[model samples]
Target chain A: MIIKNSIEGSFHLTGGDFTNAGIASSELKSILTELGLDDNVIRRAAIATFEAEMNVIIHAIAGTIYYSIMPEHIKIIVNDMGPGIEDIELAMQEGYSTAPDWVREMGWGAGMGLPNMKKNSDEFKIDSVVGEGTTVEIIINIKQGLR
Target chain B: MNIHEIASKLSLDVKTTKGDLEREVTGCYISDLLSDVMANGKEGDIWITHQTHPNIVAVAILKNLSGVIITNKRVPEEDTLKRAEAEHLTIMTGQAPTFEIAGMLYHFLRC
Candidate 1:
């Protein structure tokens, strides 16, 4: 999928690279802020991006996150090469996580990543093939004075 | 109340010297789970958690939170401190547990 928007960027994430995991979301947040988006809108976008970024770091061997800022909406696409989920419905359920104990010790892997992403985003979609990869797309509509 | 005043009132140990101590604290949210904070935490609020990692700093910055209060005398890791400093995020240490700090902050902010 191609986003023919005026602003676009991609961030590459290495699996298990916990130290640099949140950088992509931070950059996206700054971009949205620069665009003068509403605070609440920006916050939701950042949360969705951050959760997707963490999912990549914890599950995938490597991945790339692409973001586009359009006139009426902001969209983020996260594609990761990892052990794809066997059950998408189960994964979307809150408090359902396969993250290891070590990941949980880091204060993540609480089974809230995917659910929270869906909650914060206006539209969310997930696609995955077991043993292949997973892709998540999130879109947040732009509204004026909605904060 | 701002971070400086809250810290003073609660007797929190200021860990970093880089962030804005005067940043106003509009509310407080206590949780160790990153997603909970992401979904529920509001901007300019104080976050109380026992998790001390770089990701916490990222969440604080992403949510535009005013500050992070690490409970139970837990010291932030070196890398966490570095990120917190780079982001200009206020991070404080408190000997009280999460519940105690949360209660105190709740009463202080509410009253």
Candidate 2:
């Protein structure tokens, strides 16, 4: 189906499933490209999605990633079912990971995921509860009047 | 060195589709963590690591890497290899340890 005006897509992520974490982001990248989004913008959004996807698999037991592609901006939302962040500021730091040993050995938990997401996206916001869950929203503004 | 020469020089076994052998490779990164690989690796680069799993392939796909090399005689999971082939991503196996493979890759790129 041809979507002329805008595009919307969502990817479900299951927690503790390291194997399938990035598939949704990959598919989203392809769809965004087909929708004529900028390459750099697509890359930025994909990076944010990839990190959020990984966090759900590594930290939460389950989560869902929601995204929308517009002519001028791309929006991504990630929601996870797990013990939410205790300190949002500390979590946003570059190297304050709470991942376990195995996850660290896997070359993650360097405490870079959240910072990286913020660095890559043009607009970034986070919401969390100590015992409820976490939701992150990232947006990339597509440069105007560009092919 | 190009992937063709690297494959021939190391006597590595390539498990990639025909199209991948022709893709241009700029450099290589050696890391065991999928997160580090994703954060540091660039497009058109080969990733050398000991961890062999579907997640490695996932990182490669996300980064749009040139290919992947699982070192120290470690072969990727069956499904991982299959997906790599299907995705037209170049993949290879080597008996050298991770550090040794990294050295060889660095030496090759330097010369």
Candidate 3:
């Protein structure tokens, strides 16, 4: 599916920057709200982007999130450089997490990040290579007249 | 019940006035885990948690929560307060523990 009317933006993320993990999602929420998208769609996009952003902060060395908003859908791609996931299938489990103890102590890393992202997104894709990096792409469809 | 009424009944300290006190409270959710709240919390629900970080505000905004009540007198971080103010999110502090606050909110909302 191709959307004709679209707006795009990108943000650079630094690894271990827990303090600023949600900035991109916050900005995206505002952008979506300003564009008058449905509240449910905005919420889903925000949650998915926030989870992906948290993953980048907790696990990657550095990353960038590229987002595009269209009348029909929103697309977000998060690419990171770090030690990638060894087992993609296992990682999708609800309670599976590799976050360190310190990250868990911060009330995160309950192994819900990827699962929650997938739950909120209409389409979710994750690609990773060990010792190289991981990339996550999510699409949230904005249904018309579904408010 | 509205946020102000609930706060008054529970004797919650109004830490920040960024959010509307008159906003109606539909329900309440108690948790410190951000993802749990995001996944299960309903819009207009007040979130009760012990976590005091900027990300908490982010989560509250995403969930469209009516307000956030921080239990045990734990203050929000400076950055959290700033973000809350910017987002117009209510941040309240209570001297009681999570259990007590949750009970009070439940009783107040029920009434």
Candidate 4:
């Protein structure tokens, strides 16, 4: 556990698993809380991690979130195995979504996933191969603590 | 206001088991977008939306919302009710649209 001098952890996510889509991000949130990060930073990280986890659950076959904590900031990398985005620029647009009506009825797939991730993150980067998979990296700086 | 007061006042159909309607609701957030709620919805806010999927319960849990109201009398999915019950998150339904429900809450909260 990170509470005992640990600085990084990874949580696995399964695609098409609506029953447990949020487990990974909540796990990440718990680790952040255990590490005693600033509340604001934890909230930002939680939003980004949750969006990343949802992207994987909605689009990928499987995924893993790599969490790392430094004295200055928290870094989260979500890597997934599935069909990647065909158009990064289009996907970044706030209202452009490829998800079906079923996902929309679930209150997600509003094309806000990536935008929300970027909005809550101090730094964000995304990479994907159309036939392969996608990876999202997000960083949230600690507002009240520095070392 | 507490959830019990609002539920009783509105005559809502409570759909969960012993959902502790006594929890204080600080505010209300009306949104059908999960990300929008995640970005802007405050803790202890009751969420009003047309979404009935189980993920709504997950969102309510993540945000620590006082309760969830599915407007237009839309009953949540079985899994949603089950999860809400298991999580002790209050799930209710009303015969109003999203805007009307929001309006009603504003009136009650302002009083």
Candidate 5:
């Protein structure tokens, strides 16, 4: 992580690479822990980012997670190249997934990815094009504030 | 109960070092869905799953789980063992079905 006014950096993800799947999110969690952020905030960030990272790995050809941390909050933006969601509403519903059998065999691609991400993050925004890609942005505030 | 004691009683295949063998198991969580575990699993819980991937180790670490039980006699991948060893996380294997072992584990930890 590069530190100036905020701790910010980006991690690149390669699709179908399970060998190093959680490394990026793990590193982020470590940094937040060292910075002495609230434990809840750190956990929420870890879970949200991990779900996003797995999305890129399971579905995208490539993806990148860009994050910035300030004293009050942490922000993450995950962008991926994949067959983007055709219906965001349906995709966000729990127990809805289009992942193939291979992904299912690994104990992933259960329809809970999006719902879990949304459940953990304080602010979540997603946008996608049917044939191009998807982007997810998440922010978790350390201190209580307006939603 | 501690992991080592549990291992002996269950006849589990211990795959990691001894450092955490004496660590107490605080609870139990059984699931194959990674997201469900992430969303609901608690720290110090012993996880039981059919998944033998390294990411299972990652989730164990993320939740500060006591260890992971790979049920159905499925061996963990080499990478998974390496990761767990590096972190000093306990991992064991059992031949029984996931639910059966989970029941045994729940009895050990909760009863």
Candidate 6:
């Protein structure tokens, strides 16, 4: 086993598997939590990562989520090759979702994914070019000396 | 309240395992979205949801929720029930909608 506690990892999310969408984030949460992070910190990291993961499936057909863990910070990157957000401001608004009815029927697509991620993370950045792709980077600060 | 007593109070049916009804609940959260539940629901909380997907069980495990109560007279998929049972998470079905079940749970926990 790779005993890299402060390790960076990446996940390739295949959009076809709605059943397995959040599994990656779930596993990541367990690993971080077991490393003795605070519950609140873990929740923030998990929420940010899971929302990003779900967005790739619900909007884009595929994407990748990458993580970098250090003693004082956790950084995440989500890049998707889906329909790019035309208006970044509009996409960031709460309760403004473009997901179809079917996705809404599954209890997601509430327009809260991005907002939730931003709300939970200490630092958030989004860059998108129309007709190209969207990439989001989130940084969460872990207390100093936390393993 | 114990899960069984809540079931009796709400007149709900045990849709999954009989052994699970006796598990104790510490709190409750009502949400249909798995993400919200995972983000907000505390461990030992009885999750009241209208969803019947296997992902619900996965969320329960991730959040460490005590059990799940499926409201609105909807039965969970067979695989979902089996997964819940395997995880030892209580699963119940209630005739009332999600809101009603939430109200009852709130009163019970408050009392």
After best superposition, candidate 2 residue A77: deviation in angstroms? 0.8
With a 3 Å backbone cut-off (N, CA, C), the pairs that clash in candidate 1 are none
Off by over 4 Å in 4: A1-6, A143-147
| Count of residue pairs whose backbone atoms collide, per candidate | 0, 2, 0, 0, 0, 0
What's the lDDT for residue A20 in model 5?
Answer: 88
* Candidates 2 and 4, the one with greater DockQ: 4
iRMS, model 4 (angstroms): 1.1
Say which candidate scores most in DockQ. 1
Model 5 interface RMSD, one decimal:
0.7
TM-score against native, each model: 0.94, 0.91, 0.93, 0.92, 0.94, 0.87
DockQ category of candidate 5: high
Task: Report how far off residue A123 is in candidate 2 (Å).
Answer: 1.2
The global Cα lDDT (0 to 1) of model 4 is 0.86
Instruction: Give one digit per residue, the lDDT tens place, for model 3 in B3-108.
Output: 9998898999988877899999999998877889989999999999989988898889888899999999898899899889988999999999999888887887
Each candidate: RMSD to true structure?
2.8, 2.4, 2.2, 2.3, 2.8, 3.0
Instruction: Report the C-alpha lDDT of model 2 over B28-78, residue by residue, as the tens digit.
Output: 887776767777889889888887777778789888888888888887788
Tens-digit lDDT track of model 5 for B1-111 = 988988888889898884499889888888899999999998888899999989998888888899999989799999999999988899999988887787787777777
Which stretches in model 3 have alpha-carbon errors above 4 Å?
Answer: A1-4, A143-147
Tens-digit per-residue lDDT, B1-111, candidate 1 = 999999998999999899999899999988888888888898889999989988899988888899999999899998999999999999999998888888888899997
Ranking by TM-score: 1, 5, 3, 4, 2, 6
DockQ scores of the candidates: 0.85, 0.59, 0.73, 0.72, 0.83, 0.53
The sequence of per-residue lDDT tens digits that candidate 2 reaches over residues A1-147 is 233576677888898887676888898889877776667777777888899998888889789998887667778999999889999999998879899998887667888899889988889999998788999999888855246
Locate the minimum summed-lDDT window of 10 residues in model 3 chain A: A138-147
lDDT of 5: 0.89
Superior candidate under TM-score, 3 versus 5: 5
Q: In candidate 1, how many Å is residue B99 off?
A: 2.5
Quote the TM-score that chain A achieves in each candidate. Answer: 0.94, 0.94, 0.94, 0.92, 0.93, 0.92
How many collisions between residues are there in candidate 2?
2
